[model samples]
Target: MDIVLASKRRRFVWSVAAAITAVAAGDVLFYQRGAYGGQTGFALAALLLLAIACRPAIWRDRRAWVAAAAAFAFALQMVRDPGPLPWTLYWVAAGMTVLLPATGTFDDGWRWFQRLLAHALRSVVAPVLDLVRWRRVRRARSQWRFNLSDGLRGVALPIIGSGVILLLFVAANPVLAQWVDRLAGPGLWELDAVRIMIWIVLLVAAWSLLHPRPIQPIMGTFDGSGELPLPGVTVASVRRSLIAFNLLFAVQNGLDIAYLSGSVPMPAGITLADYAHRGAYPLIATALLAALFVLVTLRPGSHTAAIPAIRRLVGLWIGQNLILVASSMLRTIDYVEAYSLTGLRLAALAWMALVGCGLVFILWRLRGGRSASWLINANLAAAGLVVSSFALTDSAAFVASWNARHAADVGGRGAALDLCYLRMLGDSSLPALIELEQRPDIAPALRDRVRYVRNAVLFTLDRRMHDGGWTWHGERRLAAARAEFPDLPARLPMPAGDRMCDGRLKPPPAPPAPESSPLTVAARP
Candidate 1:
């Protein structure tokens, strides 16, 4: 049995070595290239290497195929657009793929999450320790051995003496020193801290990929018939709590309907801006907390969840939460209208929509008696779809265009034009700036600044287009913007002011009306 275990350990070592070599080679050949080709090659190489290392185990497991597909999808996304969101999704998907074969069927999302965390921790530590133990055993079984300590002791004095002699020679003879300097190239022995750190990280990542530890799924026979030990969580108490919560939410909703719906005048000293800004974020927080409470109190298979009255109350509460989410959205819209629209406000609106969807999903789960895992997966899918859509959409361009059209100078309801903000939007705002420049009513000062900004953006876009830095979407947008201003000059005149909006300069006042001629009046008489 000991020999058999040793044999298995040896085979594992060989497999790890092979995988490491393959990964290192692949990194050198493919990962050293640019993002698109590099990511594509690395994904293919990684999947192939994993297949070779895991062999029949990976080949037979259906989960392995799923993991491979996910990896491919991640690579495709990176090739399309490499950013934080796509990378985050790739890491999560890759982590799950590494643990999928080891974990058993989980009964709940919590348990599955717990096992995944454990598996990640174990994968980091187990492989290296096991390799160390195997090496120790192999050393014990060797027929002959040389002590590394004794060998180092034999060479230490000579090495020290040689270093001292070299220093003495360099100090005594300038020519020798000069010769030494000439022979020793600059940075030959110098360490690059960044490169060293990167290599170390890569090595560790490769090690983890090669020897992932298995996670044993929790399969305890203890049925979930036991009740939670909360003393005040009886059905009646939950019902009362839900009723109070509903009434409190109703009051807030009523105020929203009165003020936000434009049906009644706002009270004195309370502006619409104040009303919108104060409640948008806090209401979203309240909805989140309410969702958490419902999940905990009315957990599946719980006694509180079994009561029909409590269930009805929970559904009603969820419905109220949904209304609150809508009101929060309206508040955000109102705020954007009063102020100016920004990326954060747009994100807030999207987040509110997601929250509303989550509330609806929760009510559906409760009605249908779905598992926790189901709810978790459903929400994850929803979030992933939203994020993926956002990744493809150029949000900066949308914000820039909206702001441009709504600026006060353009006969729109928004505040004074923010050329600085538009400039910060980079190439995405070029089209809007061009459109602003073409308007006849635009002040000369503002138009000059707009032309300056547009030219700067166009220069950047032109350079990126020439240098292959611009993506297809960027190129397309630039082409469209250029088409709008067909007669734009090749060069723009510089603006006189440093500030975005010079407060000192105002629009020229209308010329005084000319007095009527006296001769013409006498002729009329």
Candidate 2:
């Protein structure tokens, strides 16, 4: 009975400590005054929240410790990149890490999915359960009088002690001081609907981790075998489909090799860019459909997969699909060369690559006679890896830098520098804009235009740095820009309308039509 009471006391103490840490850290790291945020603050808050939320597993299980560390590192990657991709990767990695003990293993994608749903359910249910537990505790302790003064008296030691320890730690580590400075940068008292929403979300996410349950996954990994009761798909149907698909894909590949080769003349009125760009995304969709058909019809252990001839046909079809994917990638690249790359185009390129990888995994699964679980896990792992890789690199900054370098303004032969688009990219384009503004090759008139855009971006970044949603990378860039160009404006330019931000007075002139000649084409790359 004494032991049970001690255990309850420990649980209550830990819960209080974790809750206090979460609230204080969240306010310091995640509170945004205005519209923009979720870069640096999110990176820090995610890790801190993971620690506090997963504290139970973290202390008891080695696997949990490893998962927490991995999540922390993954989330920390956003410090450098800080875009939508990183944000997604961080949440996925963090969520899975928090739920790892409950799921038992990471090998089954279906089980993880089941656990994800449970995680959401727990986010809503756990807090109510906690309140019930607290009520019971309060009833048990009712004999001892408690009030607001008693609560203040109880917390004083912890508050003063923690402050002293934190000061010493900061003194020992200069980096901690930097973190504190950044955390203290935003307003401390701001509150609104959005911030309240953020608070609710943070609380729910944290509490879900704190009160985890070992859920028996309801959905098991499905192996797409003949015995699974799939209907209407037969060996004969798959064989015929493969034959027709092979023939159709062959025709498409043939046209790509001939017309896209630049060695052979394209049809009248169809230019290289038109042919290349037109089929870029559509071909990817076609490949996806072909991949789905192969997965659904020629599933491993199915009669369609047993025959060597059909397997060969499937292999041939998959190879053709890969070629189609490659052609689509080439087409997108060619379009990028002719036009320019944007964040969306870059993501499209990544998506195409992911499609190609998925097709390869599908073919591998069939060849190995692997289960549906294997195929699903392999594809998901491939996708997660691709997203993680992209997350580690700042795609927006890369796009901005690439566009600026290749823009026709500095004589790189690509599209003219679109100041409007650059402005839309926000502070990610600030460094590139700064570089373009200082380039010796820029025309005097173009230099003035670049200066205006650069100033506008600089001003906005300053507001973010002071207000909220700023990154360490952004801070470094701002510092470097100040050192390089003292004349860079921190105030909004007096010029309004077209010259305000990106300064688009009129639409940019349409680019000239592409030549039909293969020699001028960049399709090969």
Candidate 3:
């Protein structure tokens, strides 16, 4: 009993030390480096501090290694160039690092995620509650000169009465009140509400990090008997539904093949754009619904999942869904070609690709009889890789270059160039703008716009260079833009026509008619 109590005391002391260290580190990071840098610093410090507070056995644990890797991924965000995608990925990695240590290897991916959430919530308050209980137990055993309750009761009335008498005496005498007020000293130790709240939040976070409660693994299969309990969903009813669902889906697939694949012309009064736009979104929605239905009816270990015919039908249905996803992609491509590609359209294409991959994985999992956990991890891995790739890629630059070259103004086969949109792309489109300006047959208005945009980009580049704000990639691109447009002017010329002088165009100043205007105004008066 004594050994156990000693060990508990030691652990508590260590936790207190870790908490203090974390709070100090947090304060230094916040006050010195600013919030973004401070957050990154605090995360790194807290991770190290927590590892120290935990058992040394963590070094040999697989989850610990995974957590370390995730922490490294998050650290990359602090030093890398600023990007929304990378920041989002960093947050995901950070969450995994924080939660994965407590999450167990569950057969259900959703269960694992749920456990992570539960652990996070428990960790936030569990330490404080445990500390309070420990203090109460310690107090109960300690032999003090007086019991806390008895001491308080004995002094309560005397303290109150002394306070009342003191107030009355101070009210009656101005000198005594002045002397009491002077004794209060300066407000050096005073804290405002905001400061108090900040300290409370900081301490809470520090304590939570110092003593995170271990998550209890939720053991047991999702379907304990290795089968779903659906009394109404018999083999025969499911078979009928599968047949009807397949037929209904077949009709949609047949039309997609005919119209999307160019086997038959689109219906009269419907342009290709109309057909493509109308089908793309709804087809994706249908595939999503079909996927949901498959998961529900043919869930692993279910009675219907054991039927060979049903399994085959589910696979076939999944394949058809993949085909539907492909059709949606083609439709989006057709629409993009008819119109133009924006960031949103590009994102839609990426999403469709991910959906197609997900459907394929679902079929694979069903065929292999794998758990939902496997399916989920595979999809997450694919998605993480895709997002990481996009984070590293300069999508804006690629879009700008593609649009610049494909525009009708550039002698390619597409709609008219939207210089305004390209200009909105900012510094990433600088090289494309420079290229646009070099074209011989470019319209005069577009050429002027390009020149204006190019000047703005150059000015921005120069400022970033001087301020040391350009990343390696930005610096390299700026160098390339400079090399391509060696003779590009430093500033744009004023517009010659009756155009508005809205910053982009510097209209010529009105002639010096002030003298004549003043004489005419005086004569009229």
Candidate 4:
């Protein structure tokens, strides 16, 4: 009995402590408020504590109740304007997970509830948001010229593109939409499933009407069993595959542009042609030109003609990949707009990696000897290195942009450091950056630049905390700077000047020095 009581007491204490920490941390991080934030904040903390306390009992048999509570929380949060709780449902569910040792607490019933909710939310939310935003946009831009081709292109391109990509996606993995619906919330799940299914059906119908031919396969296109099969899937096939993939990708890629381009600020010195050519256009063109010879050689009984055709097409493909790599590296170094660089690099890298992998696989198949195995291993290692390099390079720019000039708090040093770490983690090779702080691998100039920004962030954070609250003018400047240079790292520094104070700028108070003279005496008495 004593053991049981002690265990219960320990659990309660831990629960309360965790709850307090969560409340305090959340207030500091997100709301810029403190834990003493009135009834709502306290109520949330109480819920967290209750969750922790009942966790073990919940394991004994509170599965249905937990699910019901979670569902109720989710529903309340959705309806309330001020919001009922901060991720109340998630916290409750997570707490229940800790409590429950048994499997299948939700059972199939929980899944059903989830699906139902997801469908409803998507059905309701998306249309409402779209309608409201659309109305606002229409009112704002009343007299804009409607270019017929542009309008048609905008409409047809996204619809067709979404259709094709979704069909391929669904065909590749039928259960994906259903799974997504389950995870995202019932409303989203239902909406997405319906949207995707409708798109798939439309794409299938449209594709049939268009009667698009299969652009020759890049690999496994030639019948290996056939007499005199064209030299093991000629370069033409590879080019054709590349083109088909690019065209398919472009259609899917334009969805965001179709829907959200209106919200985007017009970039300076960027024309329509420039924007269009910047993304998947070059990829599609590269693939198409490289595969030109394959199309010419597709005629039956004219197989011998493919030799010269393959050579020319392969040369073009290699040339295109090389140019893309060079251009991408230049763009990375020069800081040309990320939108242009990222999409281009993504397609180029994926293509090159795929082709390189295929070649290695083919070599392994043909030469089953030890040397062939070693060669394949080398190719795989090179591929991995390339991928890692690309990730690190991409993340360097990402980390750099998080610099800010606010207080050394949520908006300050901590935030910048977190962003840097996030970017570093995204690349495999940059693990040492977290520990070393200054690696020889990072160029001396780049390291200096990063260190300067990091130090500035630390300084800002310290300085801001010294001041009572983040002042309006300072926050505004930080926001404006962030807007102007989205790619640069934020450089919020710790506060240091005389301005940092309580009544006169000081670090926030310690926990009452663990005792007050009167309170301690009274409690003791």
| Winning candidate number (TM-score) | 2
Give candidate 3's error at residue 79 in angstroms.
2.5
Give the per-residue Cα lDDT of candidate 1 at 390.
Answer: 70
* lDDT score for candidate 1 against the true structure: 0.69
How well does candidate 3 score on lDDT at residue 157? 100
True-vs-predicted CA distance for residue 54, candidate 4, Å: 43
What tens-digit string does per-residue lDDT give for candidate 2 at 1-525? 767665666665576567556756665556644424545545355545645553555566666666566566656666544666666555555566556655444667777777777767766767778777766666776554543357789999999999999989978998997887687653544678867877676676666655555566887877675533457666677788789999999999998887777878988998778888899999998998998787778767776688999989988998999899989988988888778889888989889989999999988888887777888888888877777777776777899999999987788867777888998887888889888888898898888888778777777777777786567777887888788888756654444445544554556669999888766756775
Give the distance in Å from residue 15's predicted Cα in candidate 1 to where it truly belongs. Answer: 6.3
How much lDDT does candidate 4 score?
0.39
Model 1 regions lying over 4 Å from their true place: 1-62, 106-112, 115-191, 216-226, 422-444, 454-525
Candidates ranked, most accurate by lDDT first = 2, 1, 3, 4
* Cα lDDT over the full model 2: 0.74
Candidate 3 weakest lDDT stretch, 10 residues? 494-503
TM-score winner between candidates 2 and 4? 2
Q: Which ten residues in a row have the lowest lDDT in candidate 1?
A: 29-38
Pairs of residues at least 3 apart in sequence or in different chains that clash in candidate 1: none
By lDDT, who's the top model here? 2
Task: List model 1 lDDT by residue over 76-110, tens digit each.
Answer: 55554455665665555565666666656535545
Cα error of candidate 4 at position 2, Å: 54
- Record all residue pairs in model 3 with backbone atoms less than 3 Å apart, i.e. clashing: none
